[model samples]
Target: MAYNPSPKSKAILDQAWDWIQSVEYQVTVRWVFYRLLQDGIYSEKKGYRHLLSLTSKARKGFYADWRPWTLADDTRAPVLVQRQGFYGLHLRGHGFQDEDDWLARIKEEINCPLDRWASQPIYSEIWFEAAAMQGQFLHYANENMPLLAFRGDISIPEKWRSAERLAERYQDLGAPIHIYYFGDYDPKGLLIPASAWRDILAWTIVILNSKGLTKLEALESLNFHR
Candidate 1:
């Protein structure tokens, strides 16, 4: 059934809709509600009932179709850059249209690599893990760390590429890989670490076995710390 928002609810929805149209990226319901409150749409309405009503209406196409804002299956997103004016990008090995010049640019300009493989070599035994804490893991909040660190979710398959790389590096270094982990003590929190370690173990085993290395037990020196 469609949500029939009241006139006041529609007014709130319209205001949020206007803000959504003005931005290029997706905006959350709470974000819209704050803007509406800031604009004095509702005088000091602390509750979320009206906001919920508007969102319900939106989801049902009563206000606006919510698919664009909510239908993302992959966690990866495009990297964005902000600047005051236009920025030009081309693969000439040169900055502009020059017939003879190839791949040469001013010294001050930052060069963009043509290769897709961007990860560099590492020589560290230390690794960090955040059990389902995406904010700390994938630099979701831009928490910077070395290449050996990573974040894991309920299913570790998504992080398998990283796990495989880490295992390869550890094997080459002939050192035990130590994972320093951060996880909540709650129900879901406690389980993520164990599950993550299981996948990591599986990934490492596959990499080692493929390499035809001996001392499988000695080579796979992986451990997780709280």
Candidate 2:
């Protein structure tokens, strides 16, 4: 069914669009809902469904000829495998003479930059509780630095893998790991990092010990802060 917004909803959408543009970043619908509540443009705690419908319609161009993806939901996006031959076709279209020219261009294109943190004494990462902010965080994050979003409380296996990665990095560079965490200041958000810190430390010690390192050595090798 097609969505037809009431005049009040249309005004709300215009306000939402203005706010979204002001931020200069794609935000989630939940973010928009909360913003409306904070701005007094909306009330009624259970009215989220109505707001979501209006936003969806606006994004799909059911109201005005609006841009499609004004609101973002990175988690729900489809993943697709990249096509390699497109590079060759693009080069040819750009007046490349032969395969040698295409091959040279492709080689340079595929040659990624040197490691950004090889000589640094600290292996740094950015962590957040909401996956929706991944794109925004990545916009300013340094190359080769890990970015992790827990999307709520992180799982045991995920923490184990994180520890393994940190252990491997410590073995390679002997650097202390630093995590610059970004999340809500709520009680649950505060607890997430605290729990993760304790668990990751224990997991890192276990991983390093299996490689014939002592507990004291493991403790010395692994360093992390939230």
Candidate 3:
């Protein structure tokens, strides 16, 4: 029989799920690990330690395998799709707000001495903005890449229509397209994008971070054209 998560493990996983749903912090595997550690859900010597070890063991196979998660599946196959705006808000040490003050602060901060590094290769190419006039930070590429936004309950037909339009536009341009997403880290948040865009395996999909090379390696191992 396959091993199931022990009660303790399940508790830790539950807390991790709660944290992601809260969207109080930027979601990443590392953050998820850290949050679990903080909530006393896992200990440094036992549970958290073991989980980290498992991550290392699973990393190679996880990246190599593109198995979709099913409700009836025995194991959880969570995809970590890193989004852009999440990092921006985290960097600014705040969450979304609907005020010109926030944008002004961002502009000022970006131009500040401490933030001179923002103009470097990393930040220069990324566009940061507040959407819907709300404080919800939106991170996107400066390259005019196509994008489609959908909530969880949205119909597949609408999703496909957006994807078809995006694909056609990119094909017309003859330029490689990349799909970038930034959202809370959770089963639903990660799986949604993976499931929606799994067919676009030929295109590059990158997570934004210093660990980008690791993601690249994972994609390459999966035989993605990136």
What is the lDDT of every predicted structure here? 0.55, 0.73, 0.40
The residue-by-residue lDDT of candidate 2 on 1-226, one tens digit each, is 2457788988999877777777866687778788888898878767777887787656443356543346665344343333346443242224556989868877778754676778997778888889998998889887577899988876544666788888887777777777788888889889998877677787677778888878898787665555
After the best TM-score superposition of candidate 3, give how far the Cα of residue 91 lies from its true spot, in angstroms: 41
Best by TM-score: 2
lDDT of 3 by residue, 142-191 (tens): 33333344445223334334434444433343333334454446777666
Worst 10 residues of 1 by lDDT: 67-76
Put down candidate 1 lDDT per residue, 22-139, tens digits, no spaces. Answer: 7877666666777777898756666456675566446434245452133221344444432333345543343445733433444356567442222424233334445245434456
Estimate TM-scores for all models: 0.42, 0.51, 0.28
Q: Put the candidates in lDDT order, highest first.
A: 2, 1, 3
Candidate number with the higher lDDT (1 or 3): 1
Best by lDDT: 2
